[model samples]
Target: MKSNFITKITLCGLLLNGIYSHAQQTTLEVNTSKTITKIQPTMYGIFFEDINFAADGGLYAEMVKNRSFEFAMPFMGWSQPNSNTHSLNANSGIATPVRTSQNSNNPDFCRILINDDKGYHIINEGFRGMGIKKDAKYNLSLKAANHNNAIKKIILQLIDKDKKVLGETVITPSSTDWKDYSSQIIATATEAKAQLKITFEGTGTIDLDMISLFPEETWNNRKNGLRKDIVQLLYDLKPGFLRFPGGCIVEGRTLENRYQWKKTVGAVENRETMINRWNLEFKNRQVPDYFQSFGLGFFEYFQLSEDVGAEPLPILSCGMACQYNSGELVPINELDPYVQDALDLIEFANGAETTEWGKLRANMGHPKPFNLKYIGVGNEQWGPEYIERYKVFAAAIKSKYPNMIIVSGSGPSPDGAFFDYGMQELKKLNADIVDEHYYKNPEWFKENATRYDNYDRKGPKIFAGEYAAHPKGVEDGLKENNWLSALSESAFMTGLERNADVVHLTSYAPLMAHVDAFQWAPDMIWFDNLNSFGTANYYVQKLFSNNKGTDVLAITKDGKPLTGQNELYATAAKDVVKKELILKLVNTSGKAQDVTINLSENNVNAKGKLIILTNQNLEEYNTIAEPTKIIPTERDYKMSGKKSVLNLPAYSFTILKLKMK
Candidate 1:
């Protein structure tokens, strides 16, 4: 009876899968002559925010947690073994966290008192434990002050879960004052979850701060730099623009804590550390170790944008804190400083060497300006107060630089009274561009595919600045990042491309999240100590961004747009320089889709490339172990004259590029 029941259950599962796999065939007519508009070069881009340990523990590539001891809980990431807390028969000393200096952004440091000759160790549990590669070199650096010149030697070793040494180094501090020390270690064994153990040789007291370790080979081989693999994923996207340092972080929980671009620039040591506004946002997925080291600061952002050939779009705080939390504001009389910061940022990015801010930029490494063209005044702000402050910023920026394009905010959600009011006011003010944010479910994304079809063409341009599809049900816990949400978002992106005339720029929000230390869900990219992988949504974004055509072409079924009809969505574009016609099709139905694509008024080559990204199950997702499970698979296609018959897989995003002859 049990065997029969199991067989029946398996049969039922197969039948249900087959039912969802039924395909709905349709004809997609692409009229090359019916060009809707010119697709903006900055159409598809990336939105970066530091939430979920995206910076300190994730991308920044710093192996030491609380490097500067600047987190609200200074001793949060450090542990002293063989001490009084963990052992009763303790012969080791204690490491005391203290704030010794004032007037600096980072003032806290750990002072270890070696009570005996026995090895007293201070261990640093890296962000989810350090990812160590066998035979790979790691650079170690720290600021130390030999209090009373009592300490003789400090030993550093990288140990695995079993306390087996992977790498080791020794540092001899020869200074009584706070001084920097550096060393290198090559790992003898690979370990994904390694801890850094620092032990004092002789009984004495030593002060330490800014304890940092990084893989010797980073992206661009820069010291104290970003993770190569993660940045490589972003660079592969070929994004049109890279919006930096942001989302809610642009607006802090308090006005005093807002992201100040000037502070993020300049020398790395002088750059003050601050508490990330996203810290402690989720009680369940709490990330208390999350903080911005700013080592990958403004200069790095502009450099990354330039490296990837993406336009830099820097968003700034407009004197108002996060509305959802504190809603703190700077009185109108005190708004000049905020406005000045905006002006200074422009100078820092584009000013000449003779200018004040430009000199600082040149000193940081790049002598020539970043060639910044666009500036965003706020992120996810709302109401009359925002409009009033925006006017002041607009006036100041325009007076100094009329050609500079300034973007204003339209609140958090895509709809609501505040969003409408903000949009209406910005329209009245003749703003250059209006930024909109959206965080909705998959169905909302599918239904809103034609969101910009009715937008005012005469008003300021639209920037779909922050958007992502949340697929999980209404639960208080974090949502799953799966293929269903990604495919749904791909369907919605068709509308964004179709209305390229009004939608000047668009990017997915919360670009990356660390699996072990994250507060937000449904992120585009996920990573851990040693490895990283892009979600299905990331590949969808890459397909759109990498192939974003130069001009928009209309692809319609019958006489109307193809959106959700027969669970299919489509958009077409032409690359003038490449002399190719690009067609993107999303099949949301269960079965495969047999569609005939008619390229009207256009001639194309016989051979082309067809790329398909799909997953058998909607709930299936890409993981660190199976990073390429949902990646695109490319194949050769033979175009049948002006008409091509292509079969799109069920629940897939397909892109076809055919040469125009």
Candidate 2:
């Protein structure tokens, strides 16, 4: 009798557990008849900044260090290592960089004086170290003013850690004045950390500036171009828009150092070098060698946008320096030149070939216009001074080009007195688009999925210009780029797509970072000398951008929007081009979720496709060693009649594509 009673109790417990599991199941209703808004093509995009050695050492493939000799501490990256560390004699050949007062912009050049024949060598440690591949060709170039033709030949060699030569080239300085010299070096072996060593043949002094080395095969095979592998990754995303030239660097430490677009165009050599705003951003990641080479300047930005089939959106400084640093504002009288810059840029982008700036653009090999449509006034500025300056810029731009859309900023944070003031003022001024930035925690992102649902529908459209969920505080210790943060962003991205009319454009900030040399943590993409890989955040971005639909459909549960109810969130869209209905679902729970989606007012095929991205651990991330660790996996999904039931795994992002009959 006791054994029978125990068996009955176990049966009862199993029955009760089954009942509770059934109760947890939910139903989602997607009404295709109720089209909320038309989705814009510029919905998902990329925000680019020069932070974290993103340009010179990260994107630009120039392997030479101190290319222009323009760093604050000239010859900071170039070093002369003694043959022996404990040598008694202090004397060896020396290379001394001299600065003249002839040019305020570029004033430094290294003067080499050879004393001992002990093979005096000056070695350049590349941004970290140059990634050299065997059987590849490298171009070595420099400007040399051989003093009285003192030096006979300069031998340039690529060496590895043990000082083994991988490649070699010889350059004979034939110019008495400053002139350019170019030679090719063919590598004999592969090395991830290679250094450029210059060996002098005779004892003499030679002035060298703009020392540069680039791969013979660059992006689009253009001379002095960007890294091919990095550009390829960007092109694969099919991004809608490309925001160029900065985050805080657009607003320099002071007005004198602010990024000037005019200085970044025309001849690459003539383009003036400027101090990067991120030079000392993080005291821990201090990089005194960081500076803008301007080789990948405005023209290159537009060219990259064109190459990726994305709209080019440029942000310019609006007469004010970085408020965080100096808060220096140009006086109203001196603001004319600032306003004139805006006008000239529009002409340079869209004007006819007969115009002055347009002629310059034509001379650079692009006769046709760049077809620029949007321009941002400032980056994360606020207060009464910003409003006053924005008013002047808006009026000037409107007077000349009324159809051009101008983007204005709403301070740094998402909420505050300054943000509120900027939004209210921009709305009153009839601003076209209002740029907002956020760098918060992952929970903040999941909770704010409906951030744009209550925005003023009739006001200026939103440009979520810069945003990323920091796993910990951005200033906190060892902030990592993990799956939890990227998954939360995927949840928030569905909301951005649902409210596409108001949220016209969005992108992740600080696009690329070098692993060894970086200031900011939690970047979207990371790279080293020869290899680059996207983070979990990058794949999330790729899924949304590549699968962005033409129109948004209403997807609700229990007659209300699904924003984290039962730890599940969802959004629906219809792709008229592909003749399919798309449903994006997120499950942020520990247990699997059983969901039955009912599609009304649309005849669907019995078979569909599902792409799911999830991992067993939330803290797991994609690194250079394993980039595809958290990528999406696709499978064929079949529907029963007009309804489809799915068992969503815990902490997963799933996308359903149902064909329409």
Candidate 3:
């Protein structure tokens, strides 16, 4: 009797399994012969902002903070540690900040007066301490004026938290006038939290400016370049374009603090330093020490885009401040300079060597134009004021460069009065592209997967300029770069791809953050002084970008696109150049999904590649310690005739690539 009971239970379980499998099975029909639209090369890209120490302390490869003594607090990063062994007292030396009238761009310089040779030294606490590697070389540079030939020699050393010198270099004062000095220091051991110590060997006075340090091994092995590790991650993504120097930074808290391209170009030292808008944007995460050194300026941004094989899409200010802050506006009559800035930027990027701005670009080492085709007028601005300013900018830019594509702003929110108004006005103006931003919960992303399905085809194209799925509502304080958020974004991106004609460009916002000094959460990448890692969302983006085909293919379930049907979303594209069919399926449910893709044509090869990215735990995310916690796994897949059967795991994003025979 017991055996019979066990057998009966097993049979019942099998019956239930069969029923569930039948219910979950989905058949997607792909029209391989019909090309819906030509997918834009700029469809998948990166949006870069300088927030969260992304530039000065993050990517710029500059180890020294307050390099030019130009921070609001001149000696913010410099501190004089009293040493018991050396008997260094306060009277040993005094460094006073001096402002000279000659150089307004870089007016501040430190003047050190040593009373005695009692070991007077100042240490720079590098952006939360430097990361020195064993056997690696660090290049140190500084400008010094040995006043009256008083100071004899200066010694520079890299020290750890315990003050153990890892490397040292010395420079002898050979001139009374300001002279440039550079030396290389080779470390004996690795230290993640190291500091730079500068000691004066003799008594008297010395004027110092632009004290900078960088790893000898930079991204391109160029002097004063970007962090190699960080740039390597970006290069691997194969992004189509790079939108840069943005977010709220383009529109400063006040007009005076806005990011001016003219000031950022020319010379590195002459680029004025300003307080970062994010310095005090969040009260709970205020970083008063945050500032922009502009070492990685406009030229560097363009070079980085080129190095990574991406188009440069630069966003400029529209004579208006951040609405969340001062909201100061330049009168319509006085907007000539702002409009000229846009026109001049075009010349700088695509002009000839004889042109004024192009001459500056050539002088900066890149004689060839960046071939810039897109320029954004403003960032997240709304209302009639924005439309007014945008109209003026549009007219001026069109008059000069009619073929140039202008990316106009559509406010901060994805939908509302501001977004609606901006869209209507831009359509009336026949705008080339409109930028939209979205920061919402994971559910919102999944629910809005078909947001662009009904968009006007003849109107301006969409640039999903800035977007990220906050796992929890941003206010709940539970924002994380977890698998759930990334999975939801993948699901939503299927809709973005399905409507390829409407959405031309897309990128995840807040590209990078310093793990130790970040003011924002949910960034795509995170890094510290020593290392960096891409979040789960980063892999999702990578898969889409790397596999974005040349043309879109119609993939439908029950004669309609599969978007949030039975917790599944999908899009298909054909890589004409590679002669392959690409299918992206995202299952956002907890149960495994059985999907059968039926192709209208029988040209697909039996052998294909399948890449799967999934995590049972939705909250799982990547960190510096466990960077590959949720990376993609790939394997060979076999297709039967024109039908491909796939069992997508719970909460997963799957990609199937098959060659056309």
Candidate 4:
């Protein structure tokens, strides 16, 4: 009897232990063997608040073929070509005539002779071993130095190696005063063929401003004209679509400064009025004509989307309500002009000959109606006042362009009419998409990734327009600009992929900013005048966005928050292209965790590749001085029996891609 009692007590203890384990159990079962999600092939894109992909604080836009600041002009000896008044201190180009060879006192032509190496200008240059061919079709532009020398017409010429003219196009100068000029040509390329000399073939000593060449392949949606390098980089991201000309900079005084799509068309150098809201911090915030010369305009955005193999997501300012600090919202009675702007924008994008905008679009070259399927009504607009404004635009736009998808933007506030009334308005108006912004710490990211997992997928889908960890307070021993949220972003992205069906599309906001630009925190891409690079977050995003899959495998895990410290995460993706399983693991622990992967049940035999982002010191960062301090690195892997074991470093994020045979 005693022996029997002892056995029963032991059994009970074991049973209790089993019960506890069950209570703390967590399992992820991928119903299918592998899931694939298709991501826009380009891992990068720009948030374009400024020139090229230089956000001065945002994402990557490879628009500028060669980047240089207005200040750096003199350093490069770009003396603005004309006038004694030219001074970098004044931030003014040579506004006067530069040609001294003429007998006339008023040699009002701006010219930069490439006759000497030191005398060359950035206008005709490119980076990464790319530049205009001496025989390539080209265009010439000049800021007419003086009204007296105003060109009646100008000829664009391309020359070959033997100084033989190969191509020329004569274009009549349109402006009475200094304005940009462009004319195209057809030419073939050859080695040693150099120099494009524009003889004031016109009656006047052509006051030259600037001239450039265009390759057959051009990207649209460029600001301050377009930066080829930046555009090329953006094209690399392979975005499915793009929403343009905004973020906090949507507000403009009157319609002229506003992104009036009409004025931004035609030859790029001629588009007038290039002003950035960021430059407003300086006194007298007069936006000197930096030449919006919108060579790449709204129409170009559409073309670029097509060229980059992505869809077009165009955004227009809603009719009535104005942006905060953008002056007061126009009342309902007086919103007619803004409303018409939105309408005209759509017509310009999708209309055919019958409409003037459409005709202009065709005249610019593309005769086919651009595929403008998505149209956002205002950016980050919220509140009942905003609701009234959104409703007005929504009703008008949907009525006019019925097939277009509408996206609404709002901050991540649970309160305010922006959320309550915005959703209510969407429900009332049958809105198609809702956009939300998030910036938080990595810890916050882990919890928030799961936050929307249970969101209502049947209703309006979500667009995580902009999100990243905005870790504010200074941490112990961390550098002032240390990027601590990269690992967190990766973990969150894994969650995003798991729910891609509900999350149709997402992009990090304030995408492109210059390193000198600091308007907002947590910018994803950074650049200087000459060189550009992406942040840690930028690389993580590149990896994931470039390798998305179509199906999702349910995740089954046998681990709980390890060691009472909830700082471990891992994910796997099946390589559709290479036929492999990819897994990413993050162990943010002070001590390492021995990670073992087992797939014997699913016949999950595989090989692995592990890439890591690790910094010995949490406060470590890559300054301009040392850029590779904390970048991702690849390592060899060994997989065992039913399990693959991994020893993860502290505070490290690892991605493992498994190739299943």
Please report the candidate that would top lDDT against the real structure: 3
Model 3 clash pairs are none
Clashing pairs in 1: 20-590, 21-590, 21-591, 22-591
Ranking by TM-score: 3, 1, 2, 4
**Per-residue lDDT for 1-661 in model 4, tens only?**
0001001111244753443332322233332363444433322233444432232112222222212122112112122332234532232122222434332212223442222222222222122212344444433434544344444445445544454656667766565556655556666654222344343323333345444544443234333334454555566555655656655545454333455666557654344434444444334332221223344566666666666666667666554224444445677888878778878877777898789878888887788888677777776667776778777888888888888778876645533655766766666666678877676666677666565567666667667776777565854211333546776676677666666666777777656654443444456555453344556666666556554544445554643222123466655556556666666666665555555566634444444556766665655665555655666666555566446666566677776655566
For model 2, state the Cα shift of residue 254 in Å: 1.2
lDDT of 1 by residue, 1-661 (tens): 0000001111244753565455556888888866679999899999999988888888888998888777788888888878875586375788888886663767778888888857679889998899999999999999999978888888999998888888899999888999999999999988888999998877788899889899998988989888998888888888889998998899998888889888887767667888787777767876566778788788899998998789999999999999998999988899999999999999999999999999988998889999999999989889988999999999999999899999889999898898889998999999999999999989999999999899999999999999988875734212367888899999999999999999999999889988777788888989988888888888899889888899999888997889889889999999999998999999888888788888786488989988888887988888888877778777777887788987777898989999988
Off by over 4 Å in 3: 1-23, 83-88, 473-479
Cand. 2 TM to true fold: 0.93
Better candidate number, 1 or 3, judged by lDDT: 3
> Which 10 consecutive residues of model 2 have the lowest summed lDDT?
1-10
Candidate whose TM-score is highest: 3
Relative to the true structure, candidate 4 has a C-alpha RMSD (angstroms) of 12.5
Query: What local lDDT score does residue 40 receive in model 4, on the 0 to 100 scale?
Result: 32
Note the clash tally of each candidate. Answer: 4, 0, 0, 62
Over all chains combined, what TM-score does candidate 3 have?
0.95
TM-score of every candidate: 0.94, 0.93, 0.95, 0.69
